[model samples]
Target: MKFEVGDKVVIQHSNDEGEVVEIINDKMVLVDVRGVKFPAYTDQLDFPYFKRFTEKKLFPAEKKPKKYIDQLPPEKPAPGKKKERIAQLADGVWLTFLPVFDSDEFGDDVVESLKIYLVNNSTLAFNFSYTLTYSGNSDFNLDGALPSMQDFYLHDIPFANLNDNPVFGCDFSLMTPDRKLAEHYEASLKLRAKQVFGRIEEIRKKGEATFSFKLFDEYPLRPYEEEKPVDTLGLGKLAGSGFRIYEASNGAAAYGVGEERA
Candidate 1:
């Protein structure tokens, strides 16, 4: 495959699309990727353009479904207030939590719901278990895998009956395709329960039914420890109260069967 100095191409290894800017030799060329230029090999590149079946069409095209949102956008941030940051659970997976309202089945009533989105922002793919706990109790749980550059909804909790629960905890455990634990992330969100209710109540008094809020602020994910291996002989000693001495196959000292030395 020959590439010219102005051909648009994608790097096979990184999948980063760029255009050829300079040709150094037959094997290498300088590619410009979003204003950044890097040397790439011709064998590690592919052209983004192809001949179309219709001669009248100049470019190739593919069909994709459109995404539709039913809820209204959240209110803008006040002056001097910064925008919330995106939360990263792992190297690539991002987590976001927001409150929203949707119409009921009858279309006559507005129902409160919480929206949880797990976005796979990197090329790595993995599965995860998501657990949401509040007020010392479990609220919602989900288990699934997210593909590259995809977003998933974890849950949509009904907010109308958050009577005694406001503070919430979230746990995410990531696993590879073979089901081994890769990483774990946990965080807490303490909503201004009373103030949130008060604001909603005031809005209700004005005869409005649907609303939304960027409820939780960004939180950081910390490293979590994995489970430790248990000691078999130590378990036996705790099962009974006696002094004994014994040796195991691995040449480690162990408690004997009811033999007293002291």
Candidate 2:
């Protein structure tokens, strides 16, 4: 009756379905399917089957031109005097795709930001990824940084203004105030992060730290999006304690360590 990582479920009465994405807080599964991932409330999705596919079952459907989510109608790109889009890019059972070489300017900016966040938080030790929008340019391909940074920034939503719920997916904070600030930082990273970045810290870099966040009894992920592709966490059942952030991973059992499996 409960779903964990790797559960194949249809969307209630619909044929649309996917594997569980990462359990962001609790009672939610980040779902992955057809090369995209999203957050979904468990109750919203019905699971009538299990173990239908293996890690080996996953294979590239075919070769095609890599399209940017920005090109999609549902999503818009930054225009003149327009602010750039930046937010946390998450998919099911997060298997980090640290595409640092994904872009040129953004890639370097994120690396610089990560370093800054680490120093500000002072917890030390961190695991952050950048989104890389594939351009098919092998020579231009940072191989990793570009794409990763691209995706990371793509999901970089408004953290500064919490009154608007949240655009950024997840953020860690040693203290509530810090969490608020981190959330704000995420929101304003693209808008105004120079001064904000000056005052934060990272976990891994430090010996140890703890984090807390608002928990969700059930959260349905965004069903499809290329930039923030879906993931398959396969969380069969989750604890009410929600998710715990120790160091820099999802948790102790998450994907074997602080994160859901890919």
Candidate 3:
């Protein structure tokens, strides 16, 4: 008999019942049994209605009175809440690369691509700008704010592009509320093909998912300078000194005394 989709059928040799999900051909059909799909011959499947009716008629079910209890069963105690544990990381900004592998039945794996991430493991928040370049050509550029103890995702690099040395540059500034601005920090890293291959081999040996290199240990800050009143008239220092100030061609001040320029 031919089976259509959505027809309930039973296997001819076994008691397993399933639904015909798709008719592959005149002789083959797709059956879904317990949420698993497999191909079976159409002749091996039959309608389950006859089998269910025959079983119900041959062995009739007996009905019994419902039992009632005076007391309810004890309830199970609720489980206590678990405390969350924070991960402790080293203090620095890091550049990490995670390799994606494609493996075959021969157990040989090839690197398909790489996932890049910028890790900010320090306590300070910073606004950062990043640029990636190869062979004097810019590949990627991004600017954003990164929170403390967080990671930012950069673009991926294909395995083939690793042969070309890529340069990564990052500029960071503190996100502070103070009026005095701190000096910006700059860092650059150049990746060579040999260096990356060595790191990848190391990761494969150690069974690590990612390889990381520290960009900087700590963020540098500029020294704070006290404010002082400006000398607008420039008369304070000229009171006793006989030197005369002359403006040079380069817009610099030249001092002279008695026709002798210094």
- In every candidate, how many clashes are there? 2, 81, 0
**Regions of candidate 1 where Cα sits further than 4 Å from its true position:** 1-94, 97-111, 166-170, 173-182, 194-262
| Pairwise lDDT winner, candidates 1 and 3 | 3
TM-score between model 1 and native: 0.33
lDDT of each model, Cα atoms only?
0.56, 0.34, 0.74
Q: Which candidate tops lDDT? A: 3
In model 1, how large is the Cα lDDT of residue 242?
A: 69
User: What is the per-residue lDDT of model 3 for residues 41-75, given as tens digits with 9 covering 90 to 100?
Assistant: 67777889867766675555788776567555776
Q: TM-scores across all candidates?
A: 0.33, 0.24, 0.54
Q: Judging by TM-score against the true structure, name the best candidate.
A: 3
lDDT of 3: 0.74
Please give the TM-score that candidate 3 achieves against the real structure: 0.54
Writing each residue's lDDT as its tens digit, candidate 2 over 1-262 gives 5678887877553457667756533444566755445445566667655423332356777888988888867747767531111213222112221111112454432321121111111222223332222232211111112221122212322323222222222322223233212222111112124323332234224311111122111223224435854435533233334754344444556547555557
lDDT of 1 at 94: 53
Once all C-alphas are superposed, what RMSD does model 3 give against the true structure? 16.0
